[model samples]
Target: MDVVVIGQIARDLAVRVDEVPGPGAAVAVRERIEVLGGKGANQAVALAQLGCRPALVGVVGDDRHADEVLARAVADGIDTRAVVRCPGTRTGLIIDVVDGGGRWRYLQDLPEAVLLTAADVAAAAPAFTTADAVVVQLQQPLPAVCAAADRGRRAGATVVLDGAPPDPGARSDLLARCDVLRADDSEAGLWADAEIGSALDALRVARELRARGPRMVVLGAGSEGNVVVWPDGEAVIPLGDADVVDTTGGGDAFTAGIVAALHEGPEAAARYGSAAAVLTVSHTGGRPNLSREEVAHRARP
Candidate 1:
């Protein structure tokens, strides 16, 4: 009940292939599956599964997938009362391909996802205003993310931004509103205009982003784990060894972990958050549906 997620929601079609296509060469597929995805939805599901109550604010079309998405959100313990049903426009969609090595490529169609108007934001104002923290992603328009962050901050909630797709031209106002800024290595590298080849490089980028305003910067270092940088000091929480399945939602899970930890305190959250992410990699799909007890059991021992 303390966390609010605002942004686009889409259904993901994930396919696992034996090899990737190289310059006009097509490859054979080993297997395929579809699931609900999108950073907003994924993170919301992650929060709920991690034992944090999360409410989602977004727009979905009047389609079967939309129905399924909403139903799934409810089943996942996410509040969908703020979700809108836009007519005519199709529910957002994503086609993701994962190679044998876990490399991924995705093509998304998000027309209806952009339908979260200012009115939609107004409807969710109460949730944002009352929550302890607000979670947002870049899948939606920059303006919406900004407005949501501003509203949440004004309401006395900690605003957390998951800067995905690595938008370097991100709005400064939005950056200033964020309490925690989370992104992967590639995104960090893009923002810093330098390659994040190592933890030190990631730390440098985190520092650069922190200069913009966020109280904390978390650079997701893939298998190398994550680096949490603050004004006082920096902490590197290495990923525990886990078998790789699909890496799509691992970062979202990590974000959920960080938020949950923040619900406690920074130091406690970092260790638990690190465990949540590592456990996610050990599971399949984008969002791992594990309870807090399960996460703690795996994370601690």
Candidate 2:
């Protein structure tokens, strides 16, 4: 499938620590690595790895980091022709601190990414219109995200929104434009007006999010699996056990899987997403070790 991913592109600096330090305490870093990451880029790469041949539409700086990010995307087989180069700005950057438990905390510098404007979205109209699906992350400016979603919908493509808007008030309009909406526990809580730590909470969040406007809603609760709600019905798809090494891009990987299997029903697509996420978390970086064949094999009952 030809999918278009719109959002942030950044270089990720990752550090491994035994534990996260307290406010005043310092901790030893066990290891450090840098890789291509950002919600948008990660999902695009995941789609490419899954044999979707995705096109990326987002902004980056004129800096060398931008070159690295774009190079990696192209190497992974993503079409980067729609990636904008903004002068006088640095590419987005993210620092991920992973603890022994495989959980992570992120610090982001996204000045350039958030600067993506309606003009940028307008420039990518060809990509949006021709794509079978368009996946948008909330990392970009609200206007740009909305514009891209609107364009994709008008083009008769399936629009999948990857996260909720930072402002709760603007979420309804965004949801209404998207065919599918996927969110992690925290984002689900923001939209559902309830905490999302447990399975029940995830289901409630999915139901509430569905009520907002999306034709389908997917709420992912790490380890608890995913709750999928669509027009027909809802289902809780459980994921298999994984040896998690990092959790940084698991959500994005899940999003890619969903887009790849969208022709299937919501429950089946969520199962494919869960399988993709299991492979991602088992690796150290945002990139997954498995290919489309491997993911399909794992998804099989």
Candidate 3:
């Protein structure tokens, strides 16, 4: 399972409080966690935990935080040889503030220089060439995302796209090259140009997205869970029975799970994804902890 992940990498600081403060009032911080995180980093970490050899492709700064996060990526069993460190730029940072009821707020320090350029994606061509799957985060510049996807498709690898293309004009091109498309509620709404108010609505949008190009489509339907559609079947998938502790990292874990189990049918993949998301949201911050046996038992497909 050789995979290439193209997206953001950042230093994460997670603070947990029973409740958010208002005005200038102060409250006690129940816990603080600092780790390697970001959409790309979290997905790669989840893949590694699921026994895939993942190579991270994203930009960072030549700062101490970059070094620390890179070391952490290596320790988590991810290949960091393709990570770019831009000179004179500050490493990206994300502050995740989670409340007692599994809600989270984020403060991000991601700058333009920390984002990948098309040239950066081109430079990591070797990784794409050898990948069995290439997972792309669409929040990056369209040029970079297209470049990575094109490289993967040309190399005969499964190209999985995460999130909707921020550029409406670029959707067709990106979808045409993608094998799978996965998006959360807001992102799914972005694709549909309206809120997905129900599972049936999500299913309709998923089918439309699949018609555009993705062989499989997974769209979030708020609390109703995820809607999955493929060539031969479709279903409204629900989350596992794990109590939600913090919703952070759940989407990334879901994407990783699907990518990891996509060798099975799409239904099995959706169940695995749902199970992984359940496990991730049960903890804080955007890092994943997964177990195959646990996921298999928890999945409902």
User: Could you estimate the TM-score for every candidate?
Assistant: 0.88, 0.92, 0.98
**Candidate 3 lDDT over residue span 130-152, tens digit each:** 79999999999999998999999
- Tens-place lDDT per residue, model 1, 84-113, is 888777898988788788788878788844
Residue 266 shift from truth in candidate 3, angstroms: 0.4
By summed lDDT, the worst window of 10 consecutive residues in model 2 runs over 283-292
**Weakest 10 consecutive residues of candidate 3 by summed lDDT:** 292-301
Model 3, which residues run further than 4 Å from truth?
none
Model 1: lDDT to the true structure: 0.78
TM-score of 1: 0.88
| Among all candidates shown, the one with the greatest lDDT | 3
lDDT per residue (tens digit) for residues 1-301 in model 2: 8999997888989898999998999999898988888888899888888878799988899899999989988998889999999988899889988999988888989884446788999998878767899898986778888999999989889999987685677888888889999988888877777678888889877777788788899987756778899988988878777898898888999999999988877888888898999899986767665587778777775
Better of 1 and 2 by TM-score: 2
- Per-candidate clashes come to 0, 0, 0
